[model samples]
Target: RKPKTLLAGVSGRARPGRVLAIMGPSGSGKTTLLNSLAAQMDKAPGLVLQGEVYVNGEICNQSMASMRKGYVRQEDTFYSQMTVRETLRFVARLKLSPEVPYEDKMAVVESLIKKFSLAKCADTIIG
Candidate 1:
């Protein structure tokens, strides 16, 4: 068995006040690259991920990146019993700062629903 190279010579910079979109066809390693950058990539036998990743001009490792960033996959794996709004509220509570008021947090969740046009299904169960 030989180790496969999922990514090689991949380099890019994401600067403040700008957007960096990773676009590609399916199975084009977009997820792999994001996982590596977010330090969420799992270590598997015979899988070698070698690269230097930096955040805000400093070298980023798992601990450092985990502290400063969050990653969400493109799939919805929320609790099937929870409604869309409920799921968003749950996530907002976990991710938002403690100083953020409950009302504000809920407001944030509402904004997300509207932003993504999920209001129609906001109260619908994920199931």
Candidate 2:
């Protein structure tokens, strides 16, 4: 569905194992829509979302239920000279389940990149 604030009333389901891109000009509420979905900011002034945000058919609000579904913001942050692996390792260390094996985690990470078609630049340095 389109965002409740700017892209309101637009509706569609994002399928698993695929990509969804929202294209628009500046001020088209693209970022605003993301902010709403992420719950990163309060609704503008008096705005409100009238329905539940579901993950796998379960509602998610206030505290995001699916922590494994990571959010990568538009503003990229990189530590100087850190390779992509190092940066991702650092992030996975801080964010991923430490109980999970490293190979498993790496596999999951790699799978995500492959599904997103990000392999061409997978090893490139972020900064």
- Model number with the top TM-score: 1
TM-score to true structure, per model: 0.56, 0.46
lDDT of 1 by residue, 1-127 (tens): 6667898888887776576789999989998888788666673344556868877677876677657554578776699999999999999999999999999999999999999999899999998
Q: Could you give candidate 2's per-residue lDDT for residues 1-127 as a string of tens digits? A: 5644445574457787777787689888776666666776474665665666665566775566436454566676777577666666677767788898888878777777778887787778776
Candidate 1 Cα deviation (angstroms), residue 95 = 15
Best by lDDT: 1
Clashing pairs in 1: none
Assess each prediction's global lDDT (C-alpha) against the native.
0.83, 0.68
Give residue 31's error in model 1 in angstroms. Answer: 0.4
RMSD of 1: 6.7
Backbone collision tally, model 1: 0
After the best TM-score superposition of candidate 2, give how far the Cα of residue 70 lies from its true spot, in angstroms: 3.7
| Model 1 worst lDDT run, 10 consecutive residues | 39-48
